[model samples]
Target: MQTTSTYKILVVDDDPDIVEMLHYNLTREGYHVAQAGNGKTAIEEAQAFKPDIILLDVMMPVLDGIAACRQLRDISEFRHTHIIFLTARSEEFSEVAAFEAGADDFLTKPIKPRALLSRLAAFKRRDAQQDEISNVIEIAGLRIDRTSFAVYKGDSKITLPKKEFELLSFLAATPNKVFSREELLHNIWGSDVYVIARTVDVHIRKVREKIGEENIRTIKGVGYKFNTD
Candidate 1:
């Protein structure tokens, strides 16, 4: 069970005012907040700040939100970080694209503070409930502990970025379940993001690098499934 102090958040946006506004509002709601002006900073903040959740922007210089989200997805530690993309693009295709990029939700720009707060509260509820389910899973020498938010390979602790850890843990939790990329985005990444199924592949590759090539079974045409047996 994580305490309230553990619920820190990172807000990624190039717009200074947006960052300031969100930082203030979220702080007022009692959430610890950090700010990143670009995708590069976002990743650095993600790694260093270790925020529990992230509010990432869709457009920025150096690195866009989508690209940044993909980068975060590669890291094991931030794998499960709740990410909501705040953007001005609201086209149907764009919304779908966000989901493909591995976002938990999307909020068009000129955000309604009330709606943002409500959605965050909902995510918080789900996060707390999920925290109770337990995360201890072992496949041979590899062990993952969800409750403690840790992973290990033969007693040696291994660190992962946010998205990478979540992907491994999710697949591990359901060994043998043939999960399509779209399914992963919807279930693991959340449907609101607008990326593509390929993002799942990116995450999988990084995870395999951490664990082993044989640890994850990619069913080529179908999708990905954990090789528990």
Candidate 2:
């Protein structure tokens, strides 16, 4: 199928080769590209570039992607930006860790450009649909009532599923902090059942989409935490 490139993507990592490789492939595909070699720079570039999507690395110096995701989440201007983690680690906990960091999705190393593009395509569709959803969490807009099985973005009502609301409430209970998938599993889903941590990622993506609010920050290699500030 023929497609037009309308998305601006930000690629952040400490590895120059990865940056170069992605930049070349993405640009060749007709999407605009931006790069940063470290976490702080990733935040800076994201702010300046105003990309439609971000491909963030898990490990970096002077503010790993997880921390920067926390900060980027605070800025209202970049609220709608979609974030996906680009990591070299692919263990049971690895994916869960990225989700805890607020990542929308994850991709392992030995870069597969085709797979990357396809994933971005799905993200684009999901991202477009997210614009109309209202995921307003609140504490009078300060406290997201992940409790009461509800979310109020300063008095506005944002509906969510039972599971989604539970997860949000748990994460929001502690804003701007990280939570590993294991912790979330035990807390949100309970530890007694058998499940993959990636289930958290599925729920997180759903939560973000439904809220229509973009404040959850993904910390690449870690887990997720809510950010209200």
Candidate 3:
């Protein structure tokens, strides 16, 4: 339901050239774009602009992107916002740190505008689909309330992390339809998040523990499926 004019994006980077580049491309693509010079400024702008998506740089003065992302995640208003960290750093630790800080995705420097636009388009599609399916989902003795962001199994309400809840809800939305790990990652985290395949397995195990393993079936070499039968 995000029209081009209504979709707001905040581009945060210390480099003016990069910021200008993103602003130009995003505007040309019919999105509302704003720019910030550093992480601190990005945080301030995010508060005022309430952008739907944020493209934040990893390194900056006043405050670093990871810390800024963490701060934003702590706030209820920005908790579900799409935040993608932009970094020149290629180290695995840096990527891990970004995710731990609550970034939805990460992007390497020297960005290709066309590719970025494609990813954004894909995200919009998924976001719209999720919106349509946000009503309470009940399947296999599980009750998922998207509005309350809560899940229940039988009579007991389960406490689940944000990602786990999303994963479970998505699987239960279409019971018995096997979804590959890669597909889950793409749909849940967006196409740009660079998480390893093991990440999905870890989350799956955690979800299974909370919801009971019998509900979610592993397809060995293939993927996973929710059993409604």
Give the TM-score (vs. native) of candidate 1. Answer: 0.65
Model 3 weakest lDDT span, ten residues long? 89-98
Model 3 spans > 4 angstroms off: 89-93, 139-142, 147-163, 174-180, 190-194, 201-229
Q: Residue by residue across 1-229, what tens digits does model 2's lDDT show? A: 1243767999998889899999999999899999998889888888789987888887788888777876776675654466777767553435555555555566778778988888787765544443344454554154444323456665566665444666787677667889998898776544333347778878888788866555677879998878655
Candidate 2 Cα errors over 4 Å, as ranges: 1-4, 90-93, 130-198, 201-229
Highest TM-score, which number?
3
Alpha-carbon lDDT, every model? 0.79, 0.71, 0.82
Every model: Cα RMSD to truth: 4.9, 10.6, 3.6
lDDT of 3 at 15: 93
Q: TM-score for every candidate vs. truth? A: 0.65, 0.59, 0.77
Worst 10 residues of 1 by lDDT: 89-98
lDDT digits (tens) for residues 56-152 of candidate 3? 8888899989999988887778867888888885634455566667776777779889878876776677668767765998887889998666888
Q: Which candidate would rank higher by TM-score, 1 or 3?
A: 3
